[model samples]
Target chain A: MASPLPQLQPEVAEKFRSTVIPCRIEMPRLGLTFDLRTLTLAEALELMKIPDFTYLVPRPKRRKAASSSTSK
Target chain B: MNTFSLTHLKGPQGDDNTPGLLGYVLVAREDAFSKIAKAPKTGTTAGETAIITDNHTFTNADDGFAKVYLTLDSNMLKAAITGERDGRGLKISFEGFHPGNNAEALEFMRIVKNLGLIILVPDADGTYLQVGAEGLPVEFAPDYDSGKLSSGRRGFTVKGEAYANGMYIYAGTVKYKA
Candidate 1:
């Protein structure tokens, strides 16, 4: 990317690395979701420490399309 | 579902200013992970072993994150979680830029666009989340822009796959192996 910084009007202090990177993850396993900036290897490991933090992807529901459409 | 209230804050717990993203993003092959790291629906101590990375153990010190350089202190980085848009999986996206377009970087970015991946995104507040961690894989949309002209801007925009769901990553122990 162009190294020349965008001509942005300085808003926050230079010391503050304020980058609006929003991330919200849902833990259906625990019926919970939270907002964050990002997830890292270390952070993933940190979540493991929360006891039973299982992140499993359930198979997609193969609903019968024709039947469902008819019902609708 | 309507349990909490979004009342206006006016007391001591009103000062809410959080930092944005910082540091590097972590990406790995999807197959490298498995049905491990079983945390309970409710518990204090972790029952069994957590997710293992290529059979290697991760420690707390250097941690398991691959710290890389970021542009604008990772300001350009973004991880948008929009839940599952399609029946297949969670449709999501992530995009950012790396400073250089060297040969090594070029080749790596080229190949990674096809790799099934789960990316770990970190935040400046010390929290994190994993994209495509919910039983699906993500690929990258690498776009290389060369600012050849005086007004042109050079950049390599890496937009991760908008498939699979991301999970709330808590503070836990991680072990990554090459």
Candidate 2:
């Protein structure tokens, strides 16, 4: 997946750190549903200010869809 | 039925202009309150605890939820104000990932998106409701590797303007059905 930052305006990019990001991720294999709309460690710290947000630790990747469905 | 009237209070004085709060702290406001006289109604065994009211059902989406009622009584108002007595606070919860495991770069954006929940705290004196300001508690745990053991799930203890001074959290057994 490509970085969505390119889709945001410069001002929005700057404010992105403060505003809440919205999304809901589902991992069927684990029967887990993570509500990304809520705050996270990276959002709390505003990692966007950092040149490389990766300076922060990485979390497990979302397991890919088994059947390749657009909507989970 | 944790309900309270809206009362406006004076904000802290300073350049910040934001209601003067020291910081976000998770004060277990519920603990301080007197336990309900009646035995808390433990709902059926479900993954999440919930309160089903005539109008709505507040369910703890992830963790166990509790139904605490905040009334307009003097004591309840006192508890809300005390939440802010110490400072501002918020509740944070997190999970996933093994610490220091050089895997693919974790999208900070994704984490920020996933691990966040907003809390709405009503003000004393029945004026307005404050949400997404004070710190409550954060529960998180990173993946454990070969007993490497990562720690993230931790609750915060805070009191002040952010939590205790004018905040009342729900208490007692979470009701599943109204």
Winning candidate number (lDDT): 1
Location of the lowest summed lDDT over 10 successive residues in candidate 1 chain B: B48-57
Q: Model 1 interface RMSD, in angstroms?
A: 10.5
| Listed models, DockQ each | 0.02, 0.01
lDDT of 1 by residue, B7-54 (tens): 344664755446666556766566555432322243333421222221
The candidate that wins on DockQ is: 1
Tens digit per residue, CA lDDT, model 2, B103-146: 32233222423332222232342222222222332222222233
For candidate 2, the TM-score is: 0.17
Docking class of 2: incorrect
